[model samples]
Target: MADKQDLNAGFTGTPVEQPEGLAKAAQSAASRVKREAYAVTAGARDHPHTASALLLGIGIAAFGFGYLLGRSSAESSASYWR
Candidate 1:
């Protein structure tokens, strides 16, 4: 078996260090997303009826869009022998 150092000896690239600002930026962005998600959850919990209505509307729209798309595609490839 080859040693670990022997295996790594093939690559001579230097290690790259991440910027301090990049780490801070990532942490801030993650925290912001977490806060926003918590707020959305709280809002939905407080307004269950609104959230349900919104979900229903989105579902209906999605179904209609899918039906239209499928119908259009099917028409384009329809057979004339029927």
Candidate 2:
């Protein structure tokens, strides 16, 4: 414990070497950027049918959520009997 404390007290050794695989890590980062750029470019055009589908999907999801909220009262009552 005393030696551990002394070790943290100051920087008293030569600089440590970095682990390998740094280049691979940088290449992976670049690949991620390329994929995101491609997605952005590909999704730039929103056709009318696609836009309509998107709106319909959103409406369905909203209706489903409201239905669930209304059903929660029954759920709570059922739990009371349990």
Candidate 3:
């Protein structure tokens, strides 16, 4: 029989020593599971400031786009008249 080490393609992380405690923790967590239990859930929802902040961002983008377009048009018009 190929030793278990050879069976694994090449996983080097620490192998399990006590499965009982890990299993107990997993069971308890599963029963009382919550979406916010994990760190990745930090920014998973829209908060109070998000709507207004997004509106402000979009407004700024529109303003900058209009400013750039107006500048370009004025430059072209001036060059055409020169």
Off by over 4 Å in 2: 1-46, 77-82
Error of 3 at 54 (Å): 0.3
Q: What is the TM-score of each candidate against the true structure?
A: 0.61, 0.36, 0.42
What lDDT is obtained when candidate 1 is compared to the true structure? 0.88
Query: What is the TM-score of candidate 3?
Result: 0.42
Estimate the overall C-alpha local distance difference test score of candidate 2: 0.79
Give lDDT tens digits, candidate 2, residues 1-52.
Answer: 4675566667678557643598668878999999998775566454656767
> Would you list the rank order by TM-score, best first?
1, 3, 2
CA-lDDT, candidates in order: 0.88, 0.79, 0.74
lDDT (Cα, tens digit) per residue for candidate 3, span 31-64: 5676545432454343537756777999999999
Which stretches of candidate 1 lie above 4 Å from their native place? 1-22, 79-82
The residue pairs found clashing in candidate 2 are none
Per-residue CA lDDT of candidate 1, range 1-82, in tens?
9987668656577548654798879978999999999999999999999999999999999999999999988887786435
Who wins the TM-score comparison?
A: 1
Our tally of clashes for model 1 stands at 0
Candidate 3: deviation at residue 53, Å? 0.5
